[model samples]
Target chain A: MNRDTLAAREPLLLGAPAPVLAGGGAALALVLAAAAALLGRRELAAPGLEIVALVVLAVAGVAAVLLASPFRAPFTAGAHAAVLGLVLLAVVLDAAAQDGRNAVVADDWGPMVLPVFLLVLATLRPPREVLLGGVLAAAASSAAVAALSPEPLRGVAAVLTGVLPPAIAATALGATTLRALRRGGARAVTRSDAASVQEEAVARLEAEAIPLLAAVEDAGTITAAQAERARAIAAGLRAALVADLARGWLADAGFRVDDPDGYAERMTAAQRTALRTTVASLPLADFERPGLASVRGQDRDAVLELALPVAARPRRTRVAPLVPLLRSAFARADVRIGDEQVSVRVELTVPR
Target chain B: MSDAVWTPRFALSDGLRAAGLWYGGTALALALASAALVVGDLRAVAVLAVPVAVIAAGGLLLVLPLPRPVAVAAATVVMTAGATAALVVLARSAAPPASTAAFPLPPLKIAMLAFGVNAGRRRAPLIAGVAITAVTETAAGLVGPALGVPWAFDLPATAGLALVALASSGFLVGGRRTAVARRASRTAAEQDVLARTRAIARSRAAAVVHDTVLGDLAALAAIGAGPLPPAAAARVRSTLDLLASPGWADPAAPPDAVGGPVLAAIARAEDPDFSVRLDGELAALRGLDGAVEGALAAAIEQCLTNARIHAGVEGADVTVLADRDGLTVMVADAGAGFDPDAVDPDRLGLSTAVVARVEAVGGSVRVFARPGVGTTVLLAVPKAAGP
Candidate 1:
């Protein structure tokens, strides 16, 4: 399945709470525990204190699962905090469970803790600092648990079994995820930079081309070879524009079009054909004829009356066949026909 | 790859020293921990100590800046040996039968595989180091339980995690290098384009200043000194007026509009210096673009100006060549010559302006001057190739 579809399905399957909620619960629990210890007497019921801790831990676990859900924002400070809280709650419960205390342990903590850390490390945006801090905290906490337990040797063994591997794994995963992100970012920046340089080069070439063409035309003796060179320069400009258009089209399709040269030849041919067909249809008979006429005849013999349909309206049906012939003639000779003149002239056509 | 290089030797010495110190410390720690456990008869603690000693040693090896390939090989051997010894001892332990299960297959194999794979990578140091750590941890975790040893089984997961960390670090380093290279290349390209553009601009400016001002002044000076004729003074003044007016000087002015005045000025500049002749119809050339005409006229004037100033001897020749390709104005002096290279066009008053105007129309200037042989300045300009 595609990432978006998979992401959509994530929360439904997991029924996870949002990371922010879990983080809030954990923070509240910590504050309450500290307040209870300091404000209330030591004789206060241990069961009551344990019950509160369990509720807070459960809330934090739920928050962690929600934050880890595929639909959650990949990189956020709140998500990291929530994941960290989940791990801490797991550690506390694991310690409690080992002591045969039924009041606070959760069945899912063993399965959830490592995975939550992994999810946080993987999805967290800019995971470097937070991941490092989390790993360090976990390692230190494990060491503390080993050192402070009543059965020091067994406690150290428990810490090693429960804490070291998971923390190290989380650290490794976090570092890898951060590297992948950094590499991907670097690749994107490089590509954009290359594209910009190419664009600038094309712009410079275009700016130079216009003045150069003008100067060549002004010289009044442009060779066929020089004209071809000018056309090549124009082709380069057309290719650049086509590439830009294709990029926009591809971006809309959710893909980036990277290779301009790959599609250039086809685009150029299509554009050239379109331009040729458009130019071929334009009438040019008026330009062929001069504004003034000069005729030399010896004494106008017999006063010949020639009624050459000067104002006859051309048949529109003749336009299609006549256009090609007219284009050919105009190509060889300078044609300056106006629209009004074409309308009033004799119609010319050829069979299809 | 070259044996002659200084870098390779330096890297080798540094790596060897670091590896020796790390390994020695690890061996000493292991010896001390073993002695403590044996004396106290703490079998459980002894099992833990062995793995801990091995791990500490491995970590120390990685922390040092040893060559990656060498480190990977060393780590693989050390981990394999440590695992074997822990397995043998754990099998004979007093733990229950279930606790003494055989080591899992894949995880142990993967650890060994990682060692070889990591050592083969291009960035060997980072890849191998992480791989060794990962494999060793995995092997320890799986093998420890089977032998009834207390070795930690978290290493495989830890190694996998380390792989991720190392990969990210590599990316950051590679990204920085790529950015630096890209910037350097861009800077070089920009500098090249700028240099070419500046050279073109400087040449054009020199030509324009010479044609309009210095040429007129020199002709007037000649006529005032009375070399030959009285009619020359009138011609000089008319030429001066055309030069002073905006009509001829401004690029936007019409060619035919300034034609009459320019032709009069040219006549004045030419008549007093030599017996002059004008060929080619001025009216026929009038239909051309104004900028083209102006460039052509200015180039011609500069050539004449050069002939008068530097020719030094009598009867210098002035030729105006024009075609569809553009115009060429040649001024040849039958006078004592000077080196063209040695003569700074700016100081000579004619060379700089003549070269600039000709090149402004995508043309060139050739100065052939030698002592006792006289000089020839040929300026060829194309009409369509403009500034």
Candidate 2:
């Protein structure tokens, strides 16, 4: 996609924010350092290595926080890996300080730190990044444990069995959270688009109608040209009324129509008159009269059909006074007539 | 969404919800403890009884109408009684006395009272349910010693305590239901008033449409007229258009939204000089409804118009504020404020339209001004009673 399309999509979701990721990364590092310090309080067998690890973690966390705004592109994916790599190095150093004793770093406290890396990385990055981060967590765990253990092969196997679940579970949770947020953002965008459309329509109506209403109220008299202008304005208002009705029906998505044709039959006598009156009140020439007419939309149906009858001649009734009103008021029309019938049946579908 | 011609759902009392959660959670905890206690005993014929009663308790809560759970209530009582009989036999068969009464409170009695009292619409069911629970707990305690199983409480004391506890819980629940029922009835009465007001408004709207729209059409169609003056003809057409369209066709009512009442009131209170500025968190206000809003809007429009014509301001400044409980709009203008007391008592505009309109819907309007200072009409309307 081009820059314009990218900009458009980013406005709603605004692709992986760096500050949040950075803050979350620093928080994880603090928690890990705190956990290590608490666990080591009993006895820091390798005091110099533990101090170096703790110092490195603080510097990296400070860098992550201070540089979050500038480090937007690829740095987001490596947040956890950076934090964990420092911890792993410290562990390796501590083990080395023990004269090749792996147990000093390979103990329960060190390996338990692997899951926190998984959680932080999974939560901060997108799905693909999370998947990659999980892979790195597992690999790092296996390598760290093996280097610190007497039996390297057994350490690799143990890390795979015990540490892998947290890595995978955290990754899945992060991916799901990312998916839900994206979906919600898309829904908001869709609603905003619809609202803007409605707003535009309302705006247009006011622009055209406001001046004309003001002119009528001001002049208190109509010239032939003004009458012609009023005729055009009246036509727009007529279309607006029908469109508003159709839009209302559309807004009610679960609306249903159990019996399509019977919908017209279901209208009360007064309702039927009101329906015709609503349409007939529009301004149009005599030639535009509909030959037949029927009432539409009353249930949950998306399509609001106002059936108008087309006549053989210019025979007019209360409903079929203007055929053009039905045409302008509806989105689509379905017409049917028998050979001997007085007028053809035209079912106009009002647009949502 | 609201119209006089349609019938909506009957109101659900909030007491029913609290009662359900309280009873359902209570029964579940009791059922689990009872099941764990008796699980290892091989002689438990009715080990399934306590668990089934828990399921029945959930079922009772699930029913929509609280009074209509008779079948579920009957099923529960039978299950509890059977469980009590089985537990008694097992306890009698056991060697230890303390083990026979180790359970905290009577599980069967608690389940029966909770579910049975839940289904009560009147006082009889409550009384009978409590009695059954007390009697059964007493029976279980009394029979324990005969079979060499010593119970925790003396039979009489156990029975008396059970009766007191069950009766208290039942009566308390019933009282909650009564209060909820009162609220529901009040809501219904308000709904009835709302429907009647809508009907009257609809008729008034139809009459206006008939008088102005059809009347203009007749004037246009008359053959006796030589020619319509431009002003006269223009008036007819514009008037007809407004009268016939959806905006005017709709009997205006309060919409749910913080600015909705003010905006709707603004829409109908159409004047060239009347302008509006709205503020506050609007998301929660959308559920507010009915003629009360329309009335408030119309009143605001009236205030703005009154300011323009009487107070000598170019246009009125309207500020809308919405908070948790209700909405308020302040229409202020730096114009010649008047001695409100000196105004003619017969002037019907403010008294009839602004004051009366808001009052009808249980709202208030305050007008403040001085000789040189501007006028500020503070129009405040509480949210209409609803969910």
Candidate 3:
């Protein structure tokens, strides 16, 4: 349903175990034969080699199963080549066994080989799928050998011994792979949840910080003690914001419980830039117009506008929304310029 | 009273001690296991026996009070040594006959080198532990045959190989866990600091609001109950205007004009002749705020009040000067001045309140006077990073 769940499910459903099982079998045979030769029992080496060739053929069967897996783009032609090599080796081994150099050739081997080939073709060539396919192939081959062998009971025992270990291992491998995928999916969900919480916290902090700052501005004449308190408060707010930002950044980046200084620094820079641009874009009234210019000269209005660009901006546009809040914060104040004076208005802007 | 009580025994110190003990016990167990292996009884019983005894001892130690770092270090060292020895034995046993002469070097030396480097670097000890485990496994593969161990290094021996693989995987998992734990701890600490800071800021903002706006509003309400005297009403009006002024928001305006009305209102409380001078272009003092103006006005008024009360002066001269660099205000009186050194900043009167007020706005105030000579107060205010 979720991205992570999909990631987990897709991998498991599409994973083919046949390749891994067949490859593992081939590798085991090769390694055993190589070891037998290296150990210097020359006469017994041929049977080992024949086994190696058969294992290679089994590997090709596994490859075919792997190709059947969903999303088999990653498994290339080289994998197919490896499977073909296995078939060639199996043929060579069968020929050598017939020559009686040193081969353990069972009479009803064709039926055993056919099931392996069919099993390989049924599953796609993903390692997990291939492993599963190999197990099935081994099972089928063992059953066929038991049914067709002259000593049916002995054949059954032999087949069971030969196929059971690999089958159990293949199944175990598939289970482990599936478990890992599920765990990964769960972890991804947890991370996303954490990230969402962090983001919500950050947004809350930002919303809180702006109002707090505005309140500080509204607080009438600050004493030395009050200023110190304000400084402390500012520092505290900054720290809180930093923490929230760090958490959010880490969560978004999928950093579970890790130091996010590097990420936070980058995010803070971007936030600061956004804040600055917002501030700069805010429409502030410009009131520095020359006092007598509008009355004194024909071009005086333009001159006044040029001189006090900020003051010349329409007051309507520069309307302060937080004026009432600020008014409640400070005492009434007056100034005397000659005999006539106007009142000072304080306004605060609450950042959203 | 309960909050003030200092109970030392129930503190974080005990927890730290417990942590240490736990680590120490773990170290001792690891050491014993390694020692047992080094003594070389290659029995399955020995493999199971030594580790179990060590773990039990470690678990017991954990309950005892001890320093955490010491316990952890000790445990880490012991585990490292034990793990290293195990790998060494495994590697030696697994070596091919032809490669047996170089047996110990490949597995044992590599593990030792990794452990030593990691210890020196003071990185994740768990990673070192895993390397040691891997090396020991390799060694076991080489030497197991010579030692006549039942397990042989050969194909079709999936059970034996799987066990080794599982151990190696465990090592990797342990390393990752350690890394994650360390990272989590650091993030938590940093987050705590940040949370504390934010709380402090919020408290400060609340305090500031209480002192400024709330105080002013209360004063306004009190004055509004009755018809204010004519002079007082004018002063109140001016004060209200100043409070509402846009210039108060500017961070670079002169203190006097910025909040002049508020102080003028306060001065009107006692003296009807109280007045403010705005000598320079008001536009030039663009960044002044309400607080700085209030402080400046209060300081001048305080000086005047002091002169009238202490020096028997009739009136004081107040002059405000604004320039590109800064603003200066001189409040001089014909009243007699006292010794500057005699004034304590903590004193209740003008020296403490007025001088402090001026300074709070990034300004300096100086009083000069002699016996029978008028005292003059010179105040200089700067306009930067202040209200």
Candidate 4:
């Protein structure tokens, strides 16, 4: 699994469908507008045309609400397109009702409503998909106007110039920004060394083990005390070996924890790395309380807490960039900037 | 191991903010330019400038770290009111029909798109879009006749800009999703590496103990407390040498470079009545990491002991299998079996001796048995630590 998959899964699996937000808003607006037209507050050339337009707008509002509902499977691109199509059809009907009242175009509502709907719909898709949808919508609307207007070319020009720029520009701008960020993030990823981790693990144990063993070899024979010492060393070695087997990057990086059950070991690689980097970024002198990092496991959930120094407490700007990675790695993360210290608490759920 | 975690380079929300600013600013500029050309009177331009300035202030809010829905709503309302007021001023100034036809509608549509795209949550963008669209359309319909502009609203322009906003928002969401997936996969791969590296470390540590501490203790036990014998001294010196060697810690060094702990355990576990019929991929055991070897050896011995002491059987079967991932050992005994779960929690036989040992090397233990059925213990160990 990837970071995107993990993060996306939370929202995609649990959150309301993407289109629902736009659909609700659209329904409210359409309903109000339909009510106004029915109340004779707005003028339509024909009474029948006015009713038909209102009915179409009401249908569009209902369609938007239906689109917002959860599907058994993924809500596909076709579904989004269909909903957008219905809204556009409402726009066409509304415009047609106002056709005779205007000199050149039907009314401003047709021009304004479609783009707003498209803008909301675009949020549900990718840049490319949005581009295709935008282009298609613009082209279809232009064609419809051109077919109806005496000045067909002028009508098409109007649509292409006035309707299309905002969506296209948004796609271009967003895509550019994302690419730049990805490029920078790639460099950060490249800096981690895997082999050094092994070296670090080996070094941690070698310090205590080598001196004791060498003294035994040099003594040549075991005295009552030496034999006793050897037995003690053996026991220590066994305990250390078992403990070391369960050790993770947290202990390796010098974070203190009362983790007798080795709950720290259950942390995913991303969590370890992110915590390591974030801790490294904080100046040691700024630490509010030394060795304040800990992981407490309750059932399958592990809650990790770290205390940032008093000096770092006010520097939220510096910590902001690091927060996203931490949040992404853990199931839930809260960073509280307090007067005494900056406290970061993260919770993650491990598999049984 | 490749990297601790994969992180998105940039935030999608920030990108949307930038886009909002760009689109909003662009629309404002266009509106200002159109008002300048249409209303030649400097006084009319100055009058239009008041609302334009307010719209600019509203656009600034989009980039601020304020609540997104609130910011977008505030900005959209400001733009709508400002644009409407400016159009009204143009109408009073008697701006030409063609100049009045387009004046603020297209630019306002773009500005509205900007607000909607930056709204940050569901329905807000649509609501912002619809609200702005309604105001602009209403303003245009009322102001168009006053100015005698043939077409007050640009329908195609509105539709086009709406599609653009939709596409942009979609792009942002897609980027965010991609970043999340990348981070998750990296996390998974890193976990795999962590486990393998742990197993490898466990193996190395076991080797160190097997050769140094275990050997020294055994020798001391056998010789008693005394001055060293020449042979014993040499053995002690050799153990010291082994501990001091940097190669012992090097992952590339074969774990069996010193001694095969798994073989030793097998030899120690065996007796005449409780023979182990060792079979299948025996050669693969030679390549086992020291941790895996030590754990497997101890666990196997414990299983055999359990079989001999408990099972009313003559012999047991031991099968070792190797695959791309690692090794799997099946120790089966046709004897008196008991429910694994019902086994005393304090009994070190299965939990500590077998389960703990196997798990230490990033391996798993599965004990399958029933009252009348045979017991089978399956131990699986990975070859290396990571993805």
Say which candidate scores most in DockQ: 4
Candidate 1 local lDDT, A10-31, one digit each (tens)? 2111111123223433343344
Tens-digit per-residue lDDT, B117-203, candidate 2: 344434543564555555555655677667665555322223223332333343344234233223333343343334323332333
Cα shift from native, residue B31, model 2 (Å): 35
The TM-score obtained by model 3 is: 0.25
Q: What's the lDDT for residue B123 in model 2?
A: 51
Better of 1 and 4 by DockQ: 4
Reported per model, the fraction of native interface contacts reproduced equals 0.00, 0.00, 0.00, 0.23
Q: After superposition, how far is residue A247 of candidate 4 from its true place, in Å?
A: 9.5
How far is A55's C-alpha from truth in model 1 (Å)? 11
Top model number, TM-score:
4
lDDT by residue (tens digit), candidate 4, B247-349: 4543233222112566456545667566666544444565567677877889988888888778878878877776656788898998988887788554468
Considering every candidate listed, which one attains the maximal lDDT?
4
Considering lDDT, which of the candidate structures 3 and 4 is the better prediction for this target? 4
What is the CAPRI rating of model 4's predicted complex?
Answer: incorrect
What interface root-mean-square deviation (Å) does model 1 yield?
A: 23.3
For candidate 2, lDDT tens digit of each residue in A257-287?
Answer: 2333334332222223223433233221221
lDDT of 4: 0.58
DockQ of each: 0.02, 0.01, 0.01, 0.11
Ordered from best to worst TM-score, the candidate numbers read: 4, 1, 2, 3
What is the full ranking by DockQ, best candidate first? 4, 1, 3, 2
lDDT of model number 3 = 0.37
